[model samples]
Target chain A: MKRRTEVVLAGLGGQGLILIGKILGEAAAIYEGKNSVQTQSYGVASRGGFSKSEVVISSEEIAYPEVLDPDVVLTLSQQAYDLYKNKVRKDCWLIYDSDTITGEGVSDKEFGFPITTVAVELRNTRILNMIALGILVKLTGIVSVESILRSLEKNIPSQFRDVNLRAFQRGLEMS
Target chain B: MHDRIKFLQGNEACVEGALTAGASFYAGYPITPSSEIAELASIRLPAVGGVFIQMEDEIASMAALVGASMAGAKAFTATSGPGFSLMQENIGLAIMTEAPCVIINVQRSGPSTGLATKPAQADVMQARWGTHGDHAIIVLSPASVQECYELMIQAFNFAEEFRTPVIFLSDEIVGHMREKVILRDDIPIVNRKFPKVDPPEYRPYQPGEDGVPPLAYFGSDYIFHASSSMHDETGYPNNVPDNAEKVIKRLYKKIYDHRDEIIITKEYETEDAEIILVSFGASARSAREAVYILRESGYKAGLLQLNTLWPFPDEKVRQLADRAKFMVVPEMNLGQIISEVKRVVEARIPVYGVNKVNGEIITPYEILGKIKEVF
Candidate 1:
């Protein structure tokens, strides 16, 4: 197993990219029995501007929280897909929202899931992030699916916990 | 002794370290990436019968800490970026007054609020020359969460030992990252020696052979004054030529005498490398990986990581310069530590730069590509 795993999640603000990174990092550290450091970079503008969170999980201690080049890149926007596609290594797996980012450059071999479309069908746009999270867990297997679900249970606010859990389950099934 | 290795952010570790070092007072404004330090101190300090005050700004934060230190209590404050800039005026005053206090500057991207919550090590030069004049300051840059815990105690110790303000220069990444930090019970700690004599004989600026003047507490039996301006031996402001010389010389000598005990650095795989990447903070992490990757691909590369930024560790750097053919510096800033590297290299070696200012960590691939290009 690789000692270090770097994952970058990029999308517009309010897409829950940072939350997803946080969930994944916490799951790795708290559940998977590893060490992880999650750091984020968000823009000034809300909604449409780029927001990225880089999570580095390792069996050993992590010195630097910033990810240089990610081994895994998850894109939820056209801009994010374009931004990360140019930098991610060929061997690096890319998980993207098939509905927003069209067929073309990196997504040819990439895992494409229409997360937003799934959320729309479920009549909840907010859970698109959980959909993305499920796909990420299934794809990478960095943490057990059960652990991620438990992590979501602990992390999500009490007010919207039920919907988020359903969204996570739907995501896990879709992947 | 084996139980306290709990998961903690760098800021929390700093609080723990300060507590271990017997810090009784903390005063600071809340700033992102570093707010946790102040928050932790607030919760932890009062529990230990210590005082934690949230000041209006960083200037007041520094002032309060210095005042608390002079009141015969260990003191500290933590801030990032613009707040650090705000604290510079008092930082110089702390130096002038020979105040023994610790200031933790958890660095974020800046000049001013460049990125409120992101990580960057752009404050290297600011930690060194943020103040106006030529005064020696001990600044320790910790790269890991564990080091953040350990260096905070060292920051307090160094500040007390030399009766100078010490800056625990750290970055947002290290400051915010959570890791397992061992909080040991029996860690060695030091406190500044205070005056034990009759109050009338005490002069706050009177130097002993080691260049450290015995400190006096406010509200104690000792009646003395401290000035930011040049002061005579008796703690009175004087424009006399000899008095000015004595003050400056004593100030410099206090830190200069302790330089040997102050300097620290970490060298990685330099025995057979041709090009050495000199870096600190997060950049050093990437540089170490870059060296590993380059070596795996059959290239001779190494890294020289500096944990103690100021007093710049010129001798260790000079030794590295003697061995490596080319030196490369990668920083989130435009150029800060690069100039320091150049100074020690003295143009004897070809020094290259892989600079980034778009608020991103310089990666191993980016650094390795540069190493390849330069080599």
Candidate 2:
């Protein structure tokens, strides 16, 4: 029923959030036969600064690429949540990582899970965003799990592909 | 895997378009927002048996591109605000020497190095006038990632066909934005029209009936001269008034006389519309969305998106103004193209500018708000 939805993923640098945004957008655009635009903005530092990526998906052409007001948001850090929490629709589905970010004064219309904790338990903490991505897929069903799997295979290197795939599957199961 | 659809960034698509257009040389310096073009070119150019050189700076990069083009290669370079300003002099050189090449400006905000990572559509006028002197330039403004690929092919085609420097002016939002692009090999590709005259009979700068000089490459069988000063048919710098006058007239006429063929503008929902929104590049994206919003609300609003930035799309805009009540120009800068629109409309109709310049894109709501006020 959703014709258009904007999703924002915010985190500190080196959180692999940009990679997650790319995979989600590619899956929707390339496999789901939908229009998608991925726009990211980050601080000047290569790492250790605030960074975020926003993807807007629509059944028709996406006119404006940036997230005007998010339908869904996944904030992995306190600073990021504080900055973007006010920039979403009142009816937005807020998803946060409880292990990495505190839920103090967070919204009532929200969900929380330890996405990073799940990834760490799986023995590769870098796949935290993949877990977040999986939960997002379960919530919105923006793109198929098969599309995400294909994107993961194309984007991830052979050396670490198995772990990333496992992380995606585990995140899906958790959701 | 045959009909591969790609979620390609606009910058990456621009590079691919150049490669597909037979661009064999790339000389560039890395800058934010536009650096991906250079990075991808460096990686892909070599695999395709082309040359990719990271020049010392923008000046050298542009100079190298000019050198490569004169040596008979489809050459290009990409830059942002600061680098675009730096390459202006060499662009003028290329213009004067009639070297066919493409220079891409992935626009960001700035009089200097302003918001290198952010998007701005301020370079609309700079692409046409950045180079010194009165010269005719072809500038193409692409709105989407697919146009980023398709228009680059057009850019290369116009460069070779007209024997002039073509500017591919794309903004930061479109440059960094990623969208699904079809990478099919069915698009038409054009190479430069080479002269068939004998070595002793060839005149490198001589204009045919179309006023475009058939390019003769360096180290070719024919001896040729290329210079920045006003040159005659012999390609030697000429300061005489008659020779200079003829050459200048030919240069302007080559593009201006063919303006009808060179200028390109796309009209959206113009039928039975009262007010029209005129915009180009990334700002046009929002203008289009605003028009959609207005029409859905039963308002008679339309959009005129300029895909060809240079030559100002004068006659076409005038034709659109004939049917519309007024015009609204929204851009990232204060108001560059609005003045041109007014000039073409001759102020018989109202042409207003909705300006924004905070290193951000103009949103649909902003443009729709302005449109509501006008209504």
Candidate 3:
């Protein structure tokens, strides 16, 4: 019943962070029947560089796309974590990769986990964003777990749907 | 309208809107922030039995759209500032020949490639007069992603209805932004009014009562010449002083006469406000927020969102300016549309500008800061 929820997915360019952002947006719009906007920022390098995708979900039309002091910030790289942790609201949910980040400046609102480690242990490193997405949905309740899986199934290639779904479930159990 | 909703980026919404408007041909070169339009068009056009081409450059892309229009295909192309500069000459050709087409400029920062990946509304003036001619133009700006979708459909309609090139002016913020939109099945689509008479009787440049001349297809039995030269009623090249005047006047008259219907602006909380904030595209979104924040702090503020920029919505702005004591113009660029706002309000009241040119957006806080300083 929240009117607006701001979520940011920040990571390196190749980490599939944009994908996770899109899935979250689709889950909100397509499955949960909410209004969503997904905007992205990336470096000129186009690969393995800093990138961020900001998504805003609302019950009504959203005028502005850029999220200011996002409610939930998910970071996959240390640089992303360091850059955004200082910027978000004090009570903001700062989720980061425990394997890659030390949770230095943000220990109070931090929900650090070994995101990459879990994906690697699951034998698929590409599902790193999916794990974060799973945890994000659970902690914020922006959208249901079923909405995330449904969006993933609609977007991901048929060959990789099952593995991505399993990774999302692994993420859900984290919280 | 489909009850189901979907999250769509501004670029993706543009493609869907064009398709809904019956755009059958797309010719554009890929540019950052605007490439998603071409990418989606390439796939969507083919699926709908249309054609999509990656032209060698922006020039050819615009030229191709003009050529496709002659053959009676609703066509459009997208580009950024640098590419928009390339398409200027051809945009003039569309204006001179009275070709019906649409051009989407997903504006980015710079006079020359200042920031390819960033968002800026600096191209507002360029879109109005970049083609280097005294001709009429209709440029519509969209503030949100849904407007990106909705305005594009109107852009196509305006192009066809007036037999002129319509510019869908979107900044990078609106072009790259994503939003939930209901893909309505009931969009009002307009096609170019075709000639009903035989080939021998048709005069391509002759305007009806509305000043819009009927368009004839290339392969159709009703044959008519299409050229970039100043032509008379018959669409033949005529350099006579009187005939040239008629050609130019008619071209301007069509849109000018219909300016009331063509220009659109949204006024918010302005009934009793002492200050009016004027903005368009992403800047308007920020300005709207500033209005509410100002109200909460006991200062009465209103917002005038210019959805139609080319004709400049002067009458509506004048009325609003008369009621308000001051006007604040905020944009991502230094001061383009602010000049127009000043011209409209004249010296009657103070007009202030909040400008930023660092390839970053003008935030609500900045607009509020400017208002605070002036008051």
Candidate 4:
């Protein structure tokens, strides 16, 4: 059987779900030379609108552009968890923010990570997305840390490249 | 070709293909099904020393593209049904002024906002006649992600070569579907031919025997006033009936005189088949697959995939219509292109339509059912 993993990153707008999706998709498709597809959906309301970026990476050919079900579901908001908690397979891993997600007994397989707390503790609240990215990198090992850093260096602006690298490293360091 | 084949959505392939085709300017508004084109363009264009502008609306997006193309940049914009409707006035302007630019209509279900993120091929006729009144257009519909990349380059080539706006008529299926796309880095790219004539004797509307007017760059000290009104060969205002008639006639003549060069269609098993399936864009993809299934089941089914949609490939369609006893038209819309097929076929054969507007693809099975029904 082909090792295929479908990941769904759900959050409110401005949480950099799209960026994380792009980075991971590019890392798999461009670096690992695997087949990957990333798609995103957002609402009309900015900032607070429910946004989600779904990605599927596989060693074999992938079809059905949208992820019908995901192997891993990561959420940053209660709305996201509520929207997607039921859809994820029972055996799949669930990652949620303990800082924001309040719904309990949803999934005993869930791992609560205080991503916002980690970002604030790192003295840069803007790195919440990077911290999440770091967690994603460590959890899956779908892509090498070097490849993620290289993609980040190429993707982020020159002014804040070092800070984002630090944030990525910090996320990699956490658990 | 680099030996790397990657799976990509049709929208992303279009972006990469545009970059490969030397497109340096893209202006578009955010709309679903077509938003990926804009997003990819925004991220990729800047890296290639190109410019991407998110205009306030489709109108400005169309205008800015025209302006950018006039400045000698290979420009393009992507829109869907409503946005395509808003772009009609400017499309007509491009028709009149003969500006070379590409417009990608990643069509979705609509008369007006019917389904914002759904798929439809309802814009086929609109692409040809949407701009209004006696104009020539070259529209290419891509059936796969590979074609999305290949046809975009062709769209630009046709636009620049003929000095008219070329429309890449895509739909939400090919616009959003993910498939393997092999991008070529060394595809033959063409740029607009700038006039080498002296500025003093230049006529913006001057046409050779071939009906193509030489393109003059704006702000080049050439003071020709390009207008949507009737003009003389010297690009000056003219109200004379003959002058207007001559200008309009030449505009049509440029495309009509070269329809043999402009028209493109793929003939699959049409040489000796009683039943012919005529479709374009996404429907053609399903039709091709359906035809293969029919062939496997011991039925003689052929497919005519229309790559060039405008000037409407009447000859090829008529030829197929004359020989085939049954014709099936599969589209994402109800009876759009089938009407044209019916017109040219002149009821010589039984015409059937496999139509869908429910925001889902009319599957190969549906088309196969229609083929069986007609057979």
- The interface root-mean-square deviation of each model, in the order shown, is 2.8, 1.0, 1.6, 5.0
- The candidate with the higher TM-score, 1 or 3, is 3
**TM-score sort, best first:** 2, 3, 1, 4
- Taking the tens digit of each residue's C-alpha lDDT, what string does model 4 give over B161-249? 88899999898777865555678776788876666788888887787667777787777777777787777887767999988898888
Reference contacts preserved by each model:
0.31, 0.71, 0.59, 0.06
Clashes in model 4: which pairs? none
Residue-wise lDDT of candidate 3 within A1-175, one digit each (tens)?
3456988899899888888888989888888877888888887777898899989888886655678658899999989988886787777889999999878655357788889889988999989988888888898787888888788888899888889888988999987
Give the winner by DockQ: 2
In candidate 2, how many Å is residue B292 off? 1.1
Q: What TM-score would you give candidate 4 relative to the actual structure?
A: 0.73
**Worst 10-residue lDDT window, candidate 1 chain B:** B1-10
Candidate 4: chain B TM-score against the reference chain B: 0.96
Q: What lDDT, from 0 to 1, does candidate 1 have? A: 0.84
Better of 3 and 4 by DockQ: 3
- Global Cα lDDT for candidate 4: 0.82
Task: Give TM-scores for every candidate, taking all chains together and pairing residue i with residue i.
Answer: 0.87, 0.96, 0.96, 0.73
Q: Model 3 off-target regions past 4 Å?
A: A1-3, A105-107, B1-4
CA lDDT of each candidate?
0.84, 0.87, 0.88, 0.82
Q: Quote the lDDT for B37 in model 1.
A: 89
